[model samples]
Target chain A: MSKGPFKLERAGLLQLLQALKTQGYLTLGPTVREGAIVYDELHRLEDLPIGYTDHQEGGSYRLEQRGDGAMFGYNVGPHSWKRFMHPPILRLFRARQANGDLEFESEGEAAPKYAFIGVRACELQAIRVQDRVFLGGPYQDPHYKARREQVFIVAVNCTQAGHTCFCASVESGPRAQTGFDLALTEVVDGEHSYFVGEVGSEAGARLLDRVAHRAAQEAEWNQALALVDRAARQMRHLDTQGLKERLYQSLEHPRWQVVANRCLSCGNCTQVCPTCFCTSVEDHTDLAGQVAERTRRWDSCFTADFSYLHGGSVRVSTLARYRQWLTHKLASWQDQFGLLGCVGCGRCITWCPVGIDLTEEVAAMNDVQTGRFAPKEAGGAHV
Target chain B: MVSLPSPIVVDPMRPRPFRVARVMRETADVVTLELEAQTGPPLRFQPGQFTMLYVFGVGEVPISISGDPQKPERLVHTIRKVGAVTEALCNLRKGAVVGVRGPFGSHWPLEQARGHDVVMVAGGIGLPPLRPAIYHLLHHRQDYGRVYLLYGARTPRDLLFPEELKRWQYTLSHAPGATPVRVTVDRAEGDWDGAVGLVTSLIAPLTIDPSRTTALMVGPEVMMRFTIAELRKRGIPEENLYLSMERNMKCAVGFCGHCQLGPHFVCRDGPVLAFPQVRDWMTRKEV
Candidate 1:
């Protein structure tokens, strides 16, 4: 069928992997290593973590074995797709003198073709957010553009939700809506195990022909829809209506001080976040001071030097730093980028050293007694 | 599986080479470098715009383009030796090569204030960025009404471009609708003959109608705040006043996120912004 809801046997995953490698692609998928589900090169079907699942919450993550042995049954992990698209450290250029004049050689043309498998819907939304930042902006980042152009995406519909998952509340996920070549819903019941594959693009339909698949029946389509509905109901929720205004009014609230006391400013949250794209430029010279290279690395807003002006750093107080990070993530980002920075994947909550749950913190600031914040007029009003 | 042309192929981070044609010492710690592009078209800049000057082996710093806008061949940057990158910029010789990016950020709105009186205020090293606007007003002297300059420095020795200031004062004296150059020193020494007080003192005695005037201010944050308060008292609306703000600008574009103030990035939205746009942000500390 042109628009297929096709059924593939659970064991046909090996055929799909081989088809990808038959073409010129490096297939990357989820696997268990070092206690977390991380993406790595997949040379064979056994590379996937079958029968394994995970439980994630604020400052905690644990692996658990499932009875049915599903290959994809978990939510997002601490590592995001940006680690490959927009690298942590990118060399912008190299400069050297030529006949008493300087010339800059750009190092942004070469990139490997990658096929990402088992991507969650929220993670795909996060990639879209980064595309808006790095590619949709006025000046495009060539390095990110090069790495992003050749990647194929295979999205996985959630069959389960983590304790920290809130993608439904943010209008990002539980199922993939767009920006994918192919999407899959893995269904396993008492005596049945199979995957319902849906083609999102021409490439996907063409690739589906290579794998062993048949047209899905009406029952199988309804089963996939029920799985999506159940996953949506299982996740946590946050009321994001009027959140920007609430954060603006609570900038000076005393709860900031309470949170600052617990924040270590270790920047682990930004490092793990899929949508945070701030960076710092560093310059280094050769030992003889002949060649100079400029590289950009990941940077965090919680650091003291992030807002340094002439005299000193603006966010010197911990209260100011924490407020900057949280407000930028939840509020001012809308004003700047016309979208919320958080995709609601909850990596920040799961990776924080003290388990600082932003949802709870935002709820605390919204409450009357704990936050001690008073609402302003209907429109935005300055204090 | 996926093969498509890149959505965007432009790299905005690369810096072009510009050789230092001349260097003039303005003060003990400050120097102005006149540069010429070694290749490509000449860089175009307007008043209140700045460029990121990168030393060969050192880092880069954002310095205002202080030259006349019409002369695109020659670029001028007046820098003070404050930090590592700035110190490296100050140590450059005549033929030294440096990387140049941008003429970034918003420019002063001089064309909008054509029929109204214009006031220029400067303090310490802030005068360089405002000098281009002054040049524009004088070149098109018939397009505007009366013009006045109010400048203040820490002391007589700390003043920059003394010869140019004297020439401008002379021109203003000879021109029609002449006004005295209101220069002040915070603490005068060595037989100083100018007014001795903060720059705010000069605003009280101006005869121009406040309702039909535009003010362009560039100085320390405290000084700009006090000057704006005095202008507000005289019935000048916040929209009529423009000021320049400074932060650690790593990229002249908006990508780096270092120079963000609230929702706006100073490097992209402005180093120069209208007073009403930044009034609430200026009031909040550590914003």
Candidate 2:
């Protein structure tokens, strides 16, 4: 509980997980699965992706050995914290018909308290972005709010930046700033391996008290800070100055059509996006017509059905769908939520099949805006 | 600093049961149904707000409230047989039960247009969504300066609430208020004597004070755009004009992100929005 940057040994992390478990929280952290690092249930410290790092680029991701045996060596993977918070599939309610009258029942299962271990800085910002989306709106999503309120975040400072990462560009990452219970900066200095932990909340202090820790030395604290600073410097740059206005004014920009040509409209980017919260509902009924349930699932704007009306889909072309997704992310999101939608985790870039980088797209749009580049004729392609 | 779970007072996604009290066929493809809540209180809504109507086995659709705002006892929805959900809704018999999650989105600026000249333009099936607003204006007729109802449909057969439209025209004609009901059709047939033109044609002929007029419209996006242009040419400010927008909706209460028109979620910030607020968004194609 002292105002000290506490130092915890490698074994201290195992005890920290045990403390969270004793506090009745389901510990979830990164693990190697299906040739990629994904967040899943973590029962032991070994479940952490130790000595493993991810090589992420546009349309590509591969796990690599860090060799230093650092616990939190990688940047984000395809999976975001939203997978656990706002699940891909959830049953909203169920109804049964009795004597020609319908009786509705809410699926009232209690939301589980989650101790999210190894949460990256950008993912923390992503969680905050979703907080405004599901809870800050006029109508709070009961399911989302329930789960989010009980979440105990353990944010990890990124000591290494992936090729796709631009959290520094968006000013959301490389170092955990706020909105976490405990912020950890992993220091793998030569033969010494430990974590410099900063308690962000009373709960964090209490949890740290239960673990083996000591006041971090000035040299150790500086080493951890330097590592995070080095990671920040390695990030790709995205000029956000007038970005909203640029995207809005460039609605007819030929670059959209150019991008749409290569864009598959497969919605891989949306799935990996931490802040994309669009969803659709499905209704199912029993064969006997006695019961019916409505299930909500994550939906992508890339799909034609996402904009369907009585006559037809509003956004018919892949050009329009792609335009909708990007515009909503960079421009309209500010108007809607008073915050930029993209956290610059670069999941959209890493997971896009055609390797479309948004930073590069914005740069192209900037060139057009400045009249420095005149796009060649797109042959009657409409944006 | 451990926070306890908040009590779940209500789940917005859950729909309340409503029984079909009466089904009045308006056209071959459209029908108006009166719904009464089976257990709870009636769904009270403003003139322009809409409800998410759910057919048991089928899907749900966002349908505007067609009943009078003053009379909240019997909820009415004028539905056209378009998709599978609306098809099920249109074919519902009396005593049949359906789920309704409602009274969402912004309403017509009735309070702002109280003393101003009210100009209402409706095209095709859009008339039903505007009926509740017309009722409000008529119920409090003395509060407004001038009231105009300009309606257009594909044909005379396609016009909704034929009997009620006639009654409204007759009653407003004899009253002290300056109320006029102008009807038009795209292509008149079978002894149809109405003006043969688009709804925009009706706006040009109306004598409205530009400063005092508050134009409200509900229809196809193209129709609304044209009507807005006509109204603008008449010197009405963009902010004074209102329109009811339609979009694909899942959660009627802004949880599902389907009903977004630019930054505004049609279910929350709109469904009814001032023209100036959505001018840029409306002009953008496939936004």
Candidate 3:
């Protein structure tokens, strides 16, 4: 419970996990599952992906054994903290017909108190973005607020950068700047692999007191700092200055059509994105017209029905859907939420079936505007 | 720091139970349901604002408040049988319970259009949504300049409130500085004596002063587009013209993204918006 950074060894990681469990938290952390590191319920330290590191780029992700026994080395995966906070689907309420009269009841399941472990800096930013969407607005989502209120974040500072990572460029990652109860910097140097625990809240400081840890040595802090710097250097760059206005101006940009040709409109990019929060609600009824349930499920803009109107679908073409997604992410999001929708976690880039790198696409648009990219000469199409 | 007008603690998604007081058949496919809230004070809403009408064990759909805004006790909704929920709602009998959430979205700026030459245009089922506005204007007859209502339907059979329209025409004829109500049909079938052409054609006979005139239109997108074009040809400022837009809405609040039109959430920002606000987006083939 000291006022400074503490050093927790590889063995001490177990005590931290045990403490979260003892505190009645539904602890969740990264685990190797289905050939990818995904967030799941954590019961033991063995659930952590020890000695595993992930290699990620556009349309690719591979987990490699580092042999260094680093517990948190992966950058990110398809799964995000939204899977816990916003949820893919939630029942808003239940309506039942009783005595020929209908009664509406908010019988949704009680929100679970989650202690999210191994949350990355970019993911922390993503959580903040979702908070704005679901909780910050005037009409707060009661369901999202109930789940988000009791969350205790265990944020991890990145020591390695995935090929698709651009969090450093977005000024959102490489280190947990804020929005975490407890922050950790995993340092794997030479024979030692440990974490520098920085308590961000009184609750985190109290929890640290129960863990087997000592004050972080000057050498250990320096290593953690060096690790973050290395990751930042390795991260890709994205020029986001004036991106909002630039995207708004490029509504008729030809590059949109080119990208549309490659985009499957499969909506995988939206599904994997940590910040995409659009959802659709449906009413389901049991046979004999007895009970009705209103359910809201995650919906993607890529789908034609997302913007369907009485006459027809508003965004009938893939071009319009792609335009809506990218424009909202980089441009109109600022207008809607006062923040860019993207957190540069690279999930969309890594999971795209056609390897459509958003960072590259953005850069290409800028290049076309700046006369650096010749659309006709490069792809046999005119700009 | 743009926030919603009010932060309601009660779940806006949940609807208050309402019972169908009376159901009047407007047309073969359309029914006008008089809904009375089962409990609590009556639901108050502005003209052109809509409510998410939920049929138990069926679904929910956004139907405009077609009744008088002044009378909040009993809500009147004119619903056409289009989809599953609407079909179920159309079949609902008196005493049937329905879930009502809203009146959500921006209302017709009737207050702003006061003292201006008001021209209201509606096509077919679009007439019901504009009925409330017409009622408001009629109630405050001295508050505006010349008022004209141009209504068009597919056929005479499709026309809504024929007796009501005749009554209004009679009342306006007897009133001082009386308003004019015009009726038209796309194709006049058997004994129909109304003008036969597009609804936009009705705009030509009316003396609309572009500088001080305000037009409110509601209908299919194609009809609205042509109406806007006719309004524009008449030299109406885009800001003075308003249109009520319809999109597939799940949650009548901003939370459900189904009602989004470009950057605007039709449920929140508007089901009614000024022509200028949607000018560029309206012409774009697919938004």
Over B54-141, each residue of candidate 3 has an lDDT whose tens digit, in order, gives 9886778999999998988999999999888899999999999899998888999998997788888998889999999988987987
Query: Cα lDDT for residue B175, model 1?
Result: 62
Error of 2 at B237 (Å): 1.2
Clashing pairs for model 1 are A51-A69
Best by DockQ: 1
Which lDDT tens digits does candidate 2 get at residues A1-383? 45578898978988999999999999999999998999999999888888888998899999988777788888888899999999999999899999888988988799889999999989988988898887776677888878887899988899989999999989998899988888999988654478998988888988988999999999999999999999999989899998888887787899999999999999999999999999999999999989999999999999989989988998989998988899899999999998899999999999998899999988888877543223222111223
Candidate order, DockQ descending: 1, 2, 3
Q: After superposition, which runs of candidate 1 have C-alpha atoms over 4 Å from their true positions?
A: A190-192, A369-383, B1-9, B172-177
lDDT of 2 by residue, B1-287 (tens): 23533433357788899999999999999999999999878888899999989999798899999999988999999999988999999999999999998788899999999789889899988999899998998898888877889999999899898888887885545245534889999988999987999889888888778899999999988888888878888999888999999999999777778888888899999999998778777777788
Please give the distance, in angstroms, between residue A150's alpha carbon in candidate 1 and its true position after superposition. 1.6
The collision pairs in model 2 are none
Q: lDDT (0-100) at residue B235 of candidate 3?
A: 83
Cα-based lDDT at residue B16, candidate 3 = 92
Query: Which regions of candidate 2 deviate over 4 angstroms?
Result: A190-192, A370-383, B1-9, B173-179
* Model 2, position B256: C-alpha lDDT score: 76
